[model samples]
Target: MVDKGGYRMASGEAIEKVYYDGQKATKALQALENIWVKRDLILREPKELNLSRPSNREAVMMTIVGTAAPTECKSCTKKDGPFDGCFVVPGVARGSCNNCHWNSEGIKCSFRPPSANVDDTPAPRKPTTTALFKKKAAATAMTATAAQDATTTPAQAVTMTPAPAAANVTVGNFEVLPLILPPSMTNAQKRLLIQTFQNMIIVLENSLTDMV
Candidate 1:
């Protein structure tokens, strides 16, 4: 069953007892605060004090208990949901009050006070097989589409002419020269050396052509 704050406490005699005690304590503290504020016994401060400080112990305790109590809307008698750590006082009661809406005549009676500031509690998480299956199916579909795209597109095939055995041997000989060269040559020097080698090769080819 729901406690005074409309929260369903754990089922047990011990829990019920604690809840009842908390409700009574909450009521008493609220009464005291109401009296103090009305009679000007406690003066409102310019700045709010930290609740954890010893000097503000009584005030803090009063605020906590008073705010924790479940308060029903005057109109709907429904317990207001906790917001910002504070309990809200419901709007004035009305005969036309429905489950979703409030019907109040006056502005003051229609509006709720600001909620108290409180610590945030984490929400519970639930596991579902349907969600897991959907995720897996989506991932599988994407993978299949990518595989199909890869197969449909042909790769650029490189063709190489088979050279004579002696010509193949010459290509391997030049490949070794780059490894044997000094590593410190600048880019300009390397380019010049390449051009010189190309000119020498052309001259040798022309001389061979003339002999043929």
Candidate 2:
């Protein structure tokens, strides 16, 4: 046992010190009374005190003594675990129980007993961008080659023309003559053509009016 002064004492000496301090005055008065009654000197009985009993503060501190931090998960190296009898990972600070045989949070941890064999291989990693691109390009090239090898129908041709040329026409006999009207015929021809066309248009308009 150690005292407040940091001096080591035997267990018996510690108990004796506590017992003597607790009832020193009472024991001395009792000893004096006994001596007066007997008219003789006599040894006093040692008072005993229970030093094993703890104070309220000491009991409270003991209750919370080893609870300074949360535990961790052993499988994922993440700090989240049960309160007792479970060794956990040291980083992540929350979620899931470490003591359960199976973790329900999709962690895929099997809290096997001490005798079970544990696999040390890490989790599979996701595919890299370069690998994924290579795979996609290979698939695309295969599909393109397949499509090219497949049978294809030819497109139908189309022709268009308005009308055919006339056959058996004599090119030398086809004459283009210049106009030669007499001086007297020119005025009469103009008047006849213009006036006659105007009169015919007037007559057609009158007939349409009568029909309406």
Candidate 3:
């Protein structure tokens, strides 16, 4: 382990000690402000990177342990070129390269494209009040129609093209609707039907009297 120090900030904050073996090491501190890092991109000053913050101390404890590749930052390249100063802070925004890659506590710094947002989970969709109300109203209308049908009189329930007349006949608990006569029947036919009906009623009455 190569144990080293003397990494200090201009504000005189001391950088935590760093240890590096040939294969793995700790990550370097990142610039606290992006603007300062942008300015230092070309004439990169190693110490100008933020050396002292609570986050830095936390990062120092997490060891960078992995075999890093050059392609780690390749996905982040823009049309202009690799982002300004990306070479200096290899894994600051994304994947670890051979120069700066690290697996902090078994978590490798994987490459992420610059276009991607940190929180990629979709927002929860909400039910619309209008849709819910329409559904409820339709259900209510169906229920009302069912209730109206159940309670409707035969006179009210049937739709007829001819003039309609109804009579109710009761047999035990059941109620039966009389047959509807069409208005197109001739008066003579109507009189004949009435006379036949009266004759049948008289015969039924005489049979009942004999039984009594």
Number of clashing residue pairs in every model?
6, 4, 0
Query: Which should have the higher TM-score, number 1 or number 2?
Result: 1
What is candidate 1's lDDT per residue for 6-104, written digit by digit as tens?
Answer: 333222332223233334433423443343221111212233233232213233332233222243335324322221122222221111111112111
Model 3 misplaced regions, further than 4 Å: 1-72, 79-83, 87-110, 113-121, 131-199, 207-212
Worst 10 residues of 3 by lDDT: 35-44
Q: Rank the candidates by TM-score, best first.
A: 3, 1, 2
TM-score winner: 3
Instruction: Name the 10 consecutive residues with the lowest summed lDDT in model 2.
Output: 36-45
Comparing 1 and 3 on lDDT, the stronger one:
3
Whose lDDT is greatest here? 3
Local error of candidate 3 at residue 8 (angstroms):
23
TM-score of each: 0.21, 0.18, 0.24
Residue-pair clash count for candidate 3:
0
| Candidate 2 structure quality by residue, lDDT tens digits, 1-212 | 23332323343343334345453433322322222121111111222323342221111111122121243336434423211223222211122222222222313444333332243234588989999999999999999867755534346323433353222212233322323333444566755654555566667667887999
